[model samples]
Target: MRTAEEIRRVVRTAVEAAVWAPSVHNTQPWSFSITGDEVGIHADVDRRLQFQDPAGREMLISVGAAVFNLTLALATLGYDPLVHLLPDPDRPALLATVRLGGPVTPDEHTKMLHGQIERRRTHRGAFVDVMIPRNFADALSAEAQAEGVRLTPVRSESGKRVLAALTRAAQEVQAYDRAFSLEVLRWARPPGTTRGDGVPADAYPLRPDHTEPDFAQRDYSRDHLWGYDRLPSATRPSAPGLVAVMSTVGDTREEWLRAGEALQRVLLFASAHGVRAAFHTQALELYHLREFIRQEMLEGEYPQMIMRLGVTAEDAGTLRRPLSEVIEEDA
Candidate 1:
């Protein structure tokens, strides 16, 4: 059994790991509270994108990813995590409370995943041409299944093209909308920014690195000349990578949380193998477009995330809020 000091240290380490989980626009819209043996994960509603994520589904999903990281951290420390999701109906913001249970040795795979919590990054540009390992898609599907989510790779050329077209359409629509543009601007950090949250100016390429079939990226740079100026080798047009959609049977808040957990799990496993993911969630942000994809592509399952996975030569650094900003410890 662990003493109080050890448990406190574990909780602090877990929160530190949890903050590294990716969030939409790098919002990092979650907070942690420690009370005795339990750690609370709460959604910071103020950080939610009101225009883009009015329903707060994406916010819940982001927090759920943090939950996965926290639990994985605890497991790595040899403690079973008892996670209570949406524990109280009256307290919607309290997403989860995790209590340290009996101790057990973490498996090799769990250790591998836990090792990647801080290293995994959300890739934002085209991937190199090298093919991913064979049967890797199967492994990713299993990871999602373990979290009650489906990871479907768009294998057919036609399917990839269709999804790409929809993404482009949505990106164009959002870029032209004043409210959507403003929301994205609010989270797009300027160069040399001291703020820890938001998509950094250097995270994306200065000029759009267009892939074949061309899935449009969010205009984080907007009207300014912001973004990384990569070398010629990195600027060359590259493959769109393996396109996949994460989906669930239901579209409830619970399902969104599951999708987020599954997302982080898949991301960590992929990162462990030197793979990275670039997200194209524009289509999913639009109601009509999301419904269309759900009906036409996903066959009724709600698509929570659209992503392309492959190996990348570049590692664009990300920023996160310091532990002091997000953690609250009981007196």
Candidate 2:
């Protein structure tokens, strides 16, 4: 019920919100195209992490998160979003197309999530020793279920330790592998770099603090001490927090996209409650480790993301590509 120009403006604002969704290494591996009133989401294959994510699973997941943001943004603006996932047969890179439909009132919950889209960040180090509300896990699980994915909290002490040990082993193996190291270094920016994308040095601590069963972090500071020098209070060792796994019934590209949507929803909802998340995705990146988790830890669900969530005082800023770099408007 809107004019052409108004629809374009709505789509444009939606894309602005979409870009804020988190991506692996801040790769921002998705692009947007607006034709008429529809927004097209495409995966930028060139930006895919070839060595680390050869299957392009992570890339699809990133695009999916963007899709969720776009949907939420449009909904928050009172426009019903009609989504078509993987609509094109020959052009597989076209992940989704969202068409704006009838207007309605935005709900309080949708607005709450939309408000946190830009504020949400990926916590790279330890979190404060505080208990997350018991109801939070159930709420987050409901969010994922709505998107057709499962968010399982690793509750058992032994189970948490196993995931931590597997993460450690995977990190150690990847650290020594030249290809993996190079891939990580490629996306790791040194302090003051002009690149708008990639994980900046300041996003992590100069030295990682240990948890009881240590969860290995990705080495953004490979050789140089290129990280934030935190205050003593922030450097105190803390627990690994709540370990959780995001999984899907199948490992297809569509399922990966669903997992990404679930991930962003969980993240935004958690952020709304002042909770932060640190990823331990090393095991998910490795083939054998991922298979082991599927069979043993996840009860046959294909695990997509492994993360720990808790409260943190630190908010290391992240960067994203300018909208001009990622958006294409039809003439």
Candidate 3:
């Protein structure tokens, strides 16, 4: 059995690892507090994308991904995490409370995922010539199944093109909406910013490659001043990697959280196998477009995440606020 001190140490390390989970524009919208033997996970409503996610569904999903990472880290350390989802009905902000439990040796898969937590980044550009192995997609689909979510790979060229066009339509419409544009601009930081939250200017390419089907990227860099220099040799159009829709049967806060957990699981698994993902949540965020995707593309399942997974040489750097800023340690 591990001592209390050892448990605390593990909790701290897990939280550190959990920060690396991807968030929309790297918002890092969750906070934590370690109390004796348990860590409390809460949604930082102030960090919520007010205009984009007014209902807090996406924000909670981001928090849930952090929770999943925390659990995975604990498993790697040979302890089971006893989690209570939204335990307090009145305190809607508290997403979960995970306590360190008895030691249980982690499997090879757990350790592999733990190793990938900090190394994964959200890709924002074109993919290499190679096609993703279908076997890997099967492995990823199983990972999603473990969390009550579905991962459907859009491998057909026609399916891929339709999704891309929907993404483009959603991006164009949202860009013109005053409230939505402001929400995204709020998170796009200026270059050389010391702030540890939001998507830094260094997180994407200054010149985005227009992949086939021409899926558009988020205009976080509206003025074309954000992101790093385009890869010098990546001048030609390339494949858009593997397109996928992460969905849950029902669209509830709980289901959204499950979707996020599955999202990170799929991401980490892909990372371990040399793949990175670029999110095109544009369509999912638009009601009509999302409905079209659900009825046409997903066969009526609620689409929670839309992304293209593939290989990229570019390393995108992300950031999160220090634990002290968000954690209510006194609680």
Candidate 4:
């Protein structure tokens, strides 16, 4: 049995790891509270994107990813994380409560995933042309299946083009909408910004680098001279890479949470193999487009995340709020 101080130390370390989980637009829209051997993950509603994520599906998914990281940290530390999702109906903000159970030795795979908690990054631009092993997608699918989610790779050329075209259409519509544009602008950090809870300028290229079929990226640099200077190699048209959609059988708060957990699992597993992901969820934010994709592509499964996975040479930067801003200790 561990002492009280030891448990507290492990809990804190787990929270530290949890904060590194990716969130939409780097909102980091989650907070934590430690009480004894349990950690409570809460959705930080104030950080939710008002226009872009009005329903809070994305917010819950973001917090869910953080929950996965938290539990993974505990597991790596030889503690079984007894996770209870949506433990209280009365408190919707409390997404999960994880109780640390008896210590056990972690398996090699668990340790490998925990090793990538901080190193995994959300790639913003195109991936290199190197071919990802066909078996890798199967591995990632298994990862998602472990969390009760499906990872469907868009294999056909026509399918990829459709998804890309929908992404472009969504990006264009959102760019023209005053409310949506402002919401994106709010999260798109300027160059040399000290703020840590938004998409930093260094995370994307100054000018958009279009992929084949032209999947549109979020206008993080919208009308401003923000973002990193791309290398000459980065300027050329790059491969679209492997496109995949994460989906759930039903679209509910619980399913959203599962999807988020699955997403982090897949991402960490890929990151361990030196692969990265770039998200293009703009189409999912819109109601009609999302429904269309569900009917046409996903076959009734609710899409939770749309991303392109491959290897990238560019080192994209990321930022996170200090623990003091997001954690509460009641130990």
Candidate number of the best lDDT: 1
Model 2 alpha-carbon drift over 4 Å, by segment: 233-235
Q: What ranking of all candidate models by lDDT puts the best one first?
A: 1, 4, 2, 3
- Per residue, candidate 2 scores C-alpha lDDT tens digits across 1-331 of 5888888899999999999989999999999999998999999999999988999999999999999999999999999999999999999999999998888799999999999999999989877788776689888889999999999988889998999999999999999999999999999998888888999988988888678779999898887988888776544747788889999999999999989999999999999999989988789889999999999988898999999999987778798889999999999
lDDT of 3 by residue, 125-216 (tens): 88876788999888889999999999999889999989999989888998999999988988888888899988888888887778998889
Count of clashes in candidate 4: 0
Candidate 2 backbone collisions, by pair? none
Between prediction 1 and prediction 3, which has the larger TM-score? 1
After superposition, candidate 1 runs with Cα above 4 Å error: 233-235
lDDT (tens digit, per residue) of candidate 1 on 169-266: 99899888999999999999999999999999888888878888788899888889998887875446479998999999999988888899999999
- Mind sharing the TM-score for model 3? 0.96
Task: Extract clashing residue pairs from model 3.
Answer: none
Indicate the residue-level lDDT of 138 in model 1: 85
Query: Estimated TM-score per prediction?
Result: 0.98, 0.98, 0.96, 0.98
What ranges in model 3 sit over 4 Å off?
231-237
